[model samples]
Target: MKYLVMVQGTQADYEAMRGKASPGSPAWSEQEVQAMYAYMSAINDDLSETGEMIDGQGLAEPAHTRTVTLGDDGKAVITDGPYSETKELMAGYWLLECESLERVTEIADRITRCPQPEGAPNYPVVIRPVMEGAGDI
Candidate 1:
């Protein structure tokens, strides 16, 4: 089975990663950021070598995102505004082909152990199975 493994974060978390201090949040130092990169890179390298990882990428900050909604006239309405500071958003994801849901869940568990500044909030790593075809339904 293939899975979309996602990691979530709030705006406060993003700011902390960028070395900006948010009240009650610890800012990540340069070395801390580098360490995080190295840790995640090691995991990616292992997954790639194991033929499990299909693709992965980090998303831009939530502030740079736009929301689109259907208007009454059926037109696409685009809007960008402040989101709740505590609202968690998808920060990144890994597309993996695994033997089973358990295997993918294990991989996601490993990601939850990624290094972080001491006071950083922990969010759940979500895993969703990808349907191979209509037959999967």
Candidate 2:
């Protein structure tokens, strides 16, 4: 089976990483950033060697996002960020071909341990099986 794993974080967290002012947390240090990248690269390498990784990518900050919806007349309506109503934004995702949900959960668990600023809370990794056919959808 294939599973999609989504990583979520708060807007404050994103801003802090980018050297912007957030409410409380300080900006991430260079060593912390490097460690995070190293940890993610190691996990990707492991997943690739195990034939579990299909695809993965990190997303830009929510400040750059836009929300689109259908207007009353069927035209597209657009709204700008930074999605004030929401506390968390999707940070990244990974697609994995694995044997079972348990296996995927294990992979997500490892991701949850990826390096972050000290005292930073662990974020949830949302996992869902990928539907490959119309019937499944």
Best candidate, lDDT: 1
Candidate 1 lDDT over 31-104, as tens digits, reads 98999899899999999999999999988878888999999999999978447743888989999999999899
Q: So what's the TM-score on candidate 2? A: 0.90
TM-score of each: 0.93, 0.90
List candidate 2 stretches off by more than 4 Å: none
Clashing pairs in 1: none
User: Model 2: per-residue lDDT, tens digit, 19-136?
Assistant: 6556665688878878988999999999999999999999988888889999999999998889668878889999999999999999999998998776665779899899999889
Off by over 4 Å in 1: none
Clashes of 1: 0
